[model samples]
Target: MMISRLSAIATAPMRNGLSSASMTSAYAELHCHSNYSFLEGASHPDELVARARDLEMPALAITDRNGFYGAVKFFGAAQRAGIQPIVGTELTIDDGTTPPKDRVDYDRWGERLLLLVEDKLGYTSLCRLISMAQMPNAKGVARLPADQLAPLSGHLTALVADPKERLPFYQEIFGRDRVFIELHDHLAPDDRSRNQRLLELAGRYAAPLVITNEVFYATPDRHKLHDVLTAIRHRTTLDEAQRYLHPNAEHYLKSGAELRRVFDRYPRDIV
Candidate 1:
C-alpha cells in the first residue's frame, strides 16, 4: 500500500543521511599554488596542508608553478595529516623556457598550464614537467614549451592556466575528454569575466571544469604580508603596482562550503 503524508517525508528525509555523506565525501581543492611558486607566495606546503586538515578536507593538490622543489615536503605533510595528496605541477610552459630574445616562439610564457596527477603515471609525468622546467633552458625561469608538454599530456591531466594561450589549440588537438578549463576566484575584479571565458572554453572542448583558490597563504589575514613579499620581489612599492596585478590580498585557502556557493548551480557530481 502506498500512502503519502507530510510526516513520512520529514520523518526520514535522508535515510540516515548516508547517501548524502557518501556523495559529498568532503569536497577537496585539487588545484592550489603554493610557496614553491617563488617569492610571490608566503606560506609553505606544510602550512597549506595543515590548513586543509583544519578544515577537514579529505584531499588536496599542490600545483606549484614550474617547480617540484617542495613535492616531497608537500607529500609528507599531507600524508601526515591524513589527507590524500594529489601530486601536481603548475607548468610554466609558455614562459621561463622560451626567451624574448629568441623572437620566434617566445610568445608563450604569458600563458601558464596547471597539471594535476590522476594516478601514478600522472604523477610521474608531472615530475617530468617539473624536472624539465627546472633544468637548463634558453630561458631563465625554468619553463617548458608545447612540444615537450604535448607528449606528457597522456600521463597527466592538464588545466590551461590563467591567461592560458594554448587553450584554443588544445581543444582542437586533445579533444574535450582529457582537458579541464579551470575557473579560479580569489576576488580579482575580472574574475567573473575570466571564469566565463574559461567555462566557455570548457564547453568548446567538451572538457570538465575545476575551480581552485590558487592559495598563496592560508587565511585572509596573511594576505597583506604576501602582498609585501611581492613588492619585495619586484623591488617596487605597493603604491606603484596595479592593484591585483601581482598579489591582491584576496588569495587564501577557502572551504568547500565557500567553493560550493560559487558553483552552486553545478552539482558536486558534475564538478
Candidate 2:
C-alpha cells in the first residue's frame, strides 16, 4: 500500500493551468501544503514550486500543518525555480484542555491559524512556536493553546484560516496590520456563508482580507488522490471517509485570472 501510494504521488499529472495564456499572474498563493503535511498533502515541495513558477506567481507560501518539516526543501526548490518562498505553518490551536477521547472529539477541539515568516525574527519565532506545540508529546498530534500565541506575534503575520469565532483571539495577538482574514471558495456548501462572515469580521476589525486556495494538490485531477490521502490520514477507507473529504475538486492551485474571477466580489482583497 505504501509503495503504490508513493508511486501514484510520484506520477500524479501536473496541471497546465499555470501555462494557460489567459492566466494573469496577479495573486500569490499564501496558504498551501506539501507532502510534509503527511497524508493530507498529495504533492512534493518541488512539484508545488515548479507549478507556481509555471503560473508566474511572484511568491508562494508553503504553510504545512504543525511543523517546518519541509521548509528547507521547499526553500531550496523555490530558489532554484526563481519563486519567492514564504515560510509559514498551519498551526492547530486548542482550548488548552485534556486530549480529546476520540477522533470526533479531537476534530472538534482545534482551529487552524496560518503564520507566515516576514523576516529572520519571524522565522525564529515560528520555529519556537512549532517547538512549543510539538515538544510536550511526541505523538503526531501537537497543538498550542490560543492564549499562548500572543507572545510570538512580533514579526510574523497571521491569517485566520476559514475565519469563524476565533477572529478576536488572533486579532488581539497579531493586531490589525499583522493579521489577515483568509477567504476561499472550494465549492463547499458553507463557503458563501463563511466568506460572508469573514468579510464582516475583517470590516469590524479593520483588518485586511486575503485570498488563499488552501491548496493540497497541484491540479483538479489530483483531487481523487487527495481524497485517498485524506482517508489514509483518518485511518479509514474511501467509502467511509465522507466526513473527512472535501466537497469538490476545486482546491487545486489556480491561475491569477481564475483567482480574480472567484474573488471578484472582493476586488480590494485580491490586491
Candidate 3:
C-alpha cells in the first residue's frame, strides 16, 4: 500500500468509544521499532498494536530504523484494534565526521534522529530521506548528510535521539516548533544523567520535550531473543556482541502509569 494511504488508515478516528477524552490524554509511544527493522525489533507490528490497545494508549508510531517497511502492516493492525498509528522512521544522520576504520567503530558512528510524518508531504519527505540514505551506501550502513536534510524538513517533526550532541543542527534546520528533544530512560545506570542533560538542552534551546521508550520488543521477556537478533545483525555471537547488547531488559513498552512513575518530574513531556 502507498504510505500515504496507510497513514490515512492509521490516523483515522477511533471507533467504539476508544477516542474518549480521557484516553486521548494518555501517553503515545512515538518511537517504536517492529520486526521490519531487520532483527533490531523483536515483535510483529500486530503484537505491538495489541499490547498498546490493552494499555489503552491513544497513539503509537512504528518507527523502524531507517525505513517504513512495517508501516502498512502497523496501520492495518491499528485500524483493526482501534488505536491511532503515527508513521515515522528513525534515521541515522551523517555529520561528515571521520569514516569508521572497522565494523565495530562503524556501529558507533552517526547520530540517530526520529522523523515523524504529520501529513502526506511529511510522508513523501521521509521516503526521499530514506532513499538518500540507502541508495548509495554500503550494506548495513545507511545515512544522509546533515545539509541534505535541511531543504526536506517541511511537514515533518524531528526528535533528536540524543539532544546533547545533535540538537544544534536540528534546531537550526527544523526550528524549535518542528523539533522536539526526546527524553528516554531505559533504567540504564547512566539514564538519569542522560535525561538530565537532555532537559538542560531543552531549556537552553526552548524546545519542547517528548518522552519515548525506544521500544525494541513488546515485553521484557523477549530481550534475550532481541539480543540474539542484534548479534546476528552484527555477524557475531552473544558473547562477542556484549558491546552492542542492551544492558538490561527494560526496553519494552511501558504503560502510561509506569511512564509517569519513571518520569514523574517531567509531566509535561510524558503527554
Candidate 4:
C-alpha cells in the first residue's frame, strides 16, 4: 500500500476542468499552513511536501497567513516530488474598521480566507496583497482590508472562509463563480458552527463548495507539538492555554476513503 501510494504521487497528472480525469482519483490538498503561519504552526515546507509525497497527493496548496516565507521552498519541493504547487495565503480581514491585536477577538472577521493567483500575474498579485497586509505593523498580524483584497479578485482562486469574513465583499465584486465557500471540520464545536455558516452562505451566494483540511500538522500524533507551537506563539504556557488547543488532531493528510467518509454528507468528491 505504501509503495503504491508513493507511485501515485510520483505520477499524478494535472487537470484544468478536463473531463478525462476520473472522479475516483483526487490527490490534492488546499489549505495547508506551514511554519510560515508565524510561530503557530508546526510543519515546515519540506515537512509538508514529504507528508504529501507519503500520502500520494498529486498537488498541494500552501496558504499560510500573513506571508509567503516558504513559497519558493514549497514550489521547489513540489516540483521535485512531481506534484503541482498552488501558492496562496489565508488573510485576516478587518471588516469592522478596527483590527484586533488579540487573536481571540480577531477570530471572526480577521482570520478568514482569500486565496488568489492565476499564472505569474496571479502570483505577483498575491505577493502584493501580502505586502500590503503586513505594511501596517500595528494591524495585529496578517490582517488586510477589503479594498486591499479587491485587486486580488478574479486574478486567482478565492476560497471564501468559514467565518465568511470577506465573502460579502468578494461576492460583490467577483460574483460567486470566482469565490469558493470552503468547508472545514476540526471535530470542534466552533469549527462545526463556522463550517455550517459557511455552507449556508454558499447557498445564499451561489458559490461552489470547496472542502479543505486547514492543516497544520501531518497527523493526530503531532497534536502535542502543535500545542507547544501555539503556546509559544501566544506567549502562554502549553497546559495553561486550553482554549487554543485543537479539540481533535485529525488535521493531518487523510486518505481518499477517509475524506469520503468525512464529507459524504455533501454531494460529489471534494478536495
TM-score of each predicted structure versus truth: 0.76, 0.84, 0.85, 0.81
Q: What is the alpha-carbon lDDT of model 2 when measured against the actual structure?
A: 0.73
Report lDDT (CA) for all predictions: 0.61, 0.73, 0.76, 0.64
Root-mean-square deviation (CA) per prediction: 9.9, 8.7, 5.7, 6.1
Q: Which pairs of residues collide in candidate 2? A: none
- Give per-residue CA lDDT, model 3, range 1-271, as digits (tens): 1233222332222221122222233766777989998878999999999999988876788999888899999999998988878899999888667656543343577878888888888889889999999888776668888789988998788877575566777878877677877777887878878877766667677776666789999988989989999888777899999999999998888775676566654345423
lDDT of 4 by residue, 1-271 (tens): 0112211333222222111232234646777888877765678888888888877777777878867778889889988987777777787666555554574343334556657455676777777877877787554465677776666655566776554455676777666555666666666667656766665666576666656677887667777888888777666897776787777787876654455566554434222
For model 3, the superposed segments whose C-alpha errors exceed 4 Å read: 1-25, 98-106, 265-271
Model 2 agreement with the true structure over 1-271: per-residue lDDT tens digits:
0011111212111121111222256566878988888787788889888888988876778989888889889999988888777888999887556666543233456778888887788788888999888888647777887777888887777877565667776777887666777777886788877777766666676766566789998888888988998887667899998998898888888877876577554445323
- Superposition-based RMSD of candidate 3 using all C-alpha atoms, in angstroms: 5.7
When summed lDDT is taken over every stretch of 10 residues in candidate 4, the lowest stretch is 11-20
> For model 1, how does the per-residue alpha-carbon lDDT over 1-271 read when each residue is reduced to its tens digit?
0112111211111111112322242656666777776666678888899989998877777877676667889889988999877767667664434355542222233467766666677667767877777676554455566677666665455666453566666655444445656666665566767767766655565555555667778777877777776665555787764443443655787776676565554444433
Which structure among the candidates has the greatest lDDT? Answer: 3
Q: Is candidate 2 or candidate 4 better by TM-score?
A: 2
Rate residue 227 of model 4 by lDDT: 82
Native-referenced Cα lDDT, model 3: 0.76
Count clashing residue pairs in model 4: 2
User: How many clashes (backbone N, Cα, C below 3 Å) per candidate?
Assistant: 3, 0, 0, 2
